[model samples]
Target: MNKFIVVTGGTKGIGLAILQKFAQQGFDVATCSRSQKDLDTLKSELEKQHSCNVIVVKADMSKRNDIKVFSDAVIKLNRPVDVLVNNAGYFAQGQICTEPEGTLENTMEANVYSAYYMTRELVSLMKKNKKGHIFNMCSVASIKAYPSGASYGISKFALLGFSKVLREELKKYGIRVTAVMPGATRTASWEKSDLPEDRFMKSEDIADLVYASHALSDKSVVEEIVIRPQLGDI
Candidate 1:
């Protein structure tokens, strides 16, 4: 059976880049997005270009029930999951004092809980096989707090912590976990911004790093990576 890779929020942005990268490498790719139309489009595009199987599902990663349904679908494939990328997240800019109630919770739901629930559901399968690589899409906010980053920063911080914990816990089982922290990536999130493309890192750059990390020998693992543009955070 072909090896499988699962990615969340893969219709566009960094997630889409990772999905395409793996598919190009001939891995059977399973990914999800909230938009069914986008999912269909992506499935068609990838299938047209790659020989590997592309499984696209509609899923709201922020909701636990949706994740359960998505997880069940992936598990049904019965292929060992070679890689899991928790890339479903959003950026909500607001200060804690000024932001309305539930802002923090909502951000946490999308950025933190989504990864937590999805991992909890699929980690056992990885454990059973004693081999897997998990990537948590963290950010520079995880390490340094900035203005208007209260809620989003908090969530990424929690995600970084979770990634670290998973790395330590899964080491004994031969499972590798990595935290990918990229600064100011060029994605839909910045589409409206006037900043030049050179000011931001490319999503494909992050994907290349992920592919390299996964391609490394089984004896070595890149636990954490912080990638920034040449000019630095914008």
Candidate 2:
């Protein structure tokens, strides 16, 4: 059976790049996004362009019920996901005191809660096989604190700690967990920021790193990798 890779937020930006890379490499690629229209378009594009097995499920990652439904759909395909990439997230930027309560709550739900639910539900399939690679899409916000980035940073910081514990717990089962933290990435989220395009990293660049790191020998696992743009911090 062909290996399968599952990516969330696969309709656009970094998630889209990772999905394309996996498809090009002949992996059975499965992904989820909230927009059924976007998922349909992505399915047609990948099938036409790459001639590979690509599955897109409409899922709102922020909701636990949606993730459960998405996982059930993926499993019904009858192929175990060999890798899971938790890339579904949102961004909220504002001064701390001025930021609304909704902003903080939404950020936490999208960034942290979504990932926790996905991993918790999806691990059963991986645990049955006792072989899998799980990558959490963390950010520089995880490693370093920044001004006016409290809400986003808090969730990412929690993810970093969660990744560490997940590593230790899953290690015995032959599952490798990695936290990939990129300084700044030029995605829809970054576009909304007042920063220049050149001030950040490309989504494709991060996708390439993901592919390469996973290609390493099974005996050699990278627990965490932090990458920053050469120019400087945005």
Candidate 3:
């Protein structure tokens, strides 16, 4: 049986690249996004391009119910989840003191709560199987505070801490957990930017790192990965 991998926000950017990488490697890929049309389009394209199974669900990862529904859909596949990538997140820009009241809370909900709820819903299966890999998409702001980063940075810091704790907790269960922190990766988030593409790392670079981490022996786990462009943060 082909291994199964679930990725959140799989319609575009790094998430889409990861899905493509794993699908090319023959892993049955399942993913979710907020847009039904995007899901449908991605499903059609991936199924046509890759021989492996492609499962797409229209789900808003920030909602607990949506996360539950998404997890249930994957569990119904009856295939043990070999990997879960928590890659759904949004970027918010503002100074900590100047941002609107709900900005911080909403950012936390989108970036932190989404990953937490999704992992909580799916981790039991990994524990039951005594095997699995989980990747949490963090950011360079996770470690270094940047001006105007505000809520997004706070959310990523929380996510990185969560990933670290999960790694320690799941070590006994033979599950691997990794926090992926990338600096200035080119994605949809930067579509309006005037900077050249070379100023940022490609999403495929992150995907390749993810595949490499998973390719390692079960006994050797990469707890965290920090990828940056050779030109440095932009």
User: Which candidate do you rate higher for TM-score, 2 or 3?
Assistant: 3
- In terms of lDDT, the poorest run of 10 residues in model 2 is 189-198
Mark the 10 consecutive residues where model 1 has the least summed lDDT: 141-150
The number of clashing residue pairs in each candidate reads 0, 0, 0
> Which has the higher lDDT value, candidate number 2 or candidate number 3?
3
Tens-place lDDT digits, model 3, residues 1-234: 999999999999999999999999999999999999999999999999999889988889888888988999998887799999999999978998898899988999889999998898889999999999999999999999987789999999999999999999999999999999999988999888899878999899999999999999998999889989999987
123-165 per-residue lDDT for model 1 (tens digits): 9999999999999999999998976879999999999999999
Residue range with the least summed lDDT across 10 consecutive positions in model 3: 56-65
- lDDT of candidate 3 at residue 55, scale 0 to 100: 91
Query: Model 3: which residue pairs collide?
Result: none
Candidate 1 clashes between residue pairs 3 or more apart in a chain or in different chains: none
Residue 136 lDDT, candidate 2, scale 0-100: 95
- Candidate 2 stretches with Cα past 4 Å from truth are none
What CA RMSD would you report for each candidate? 0.7, 1.3, 0.7
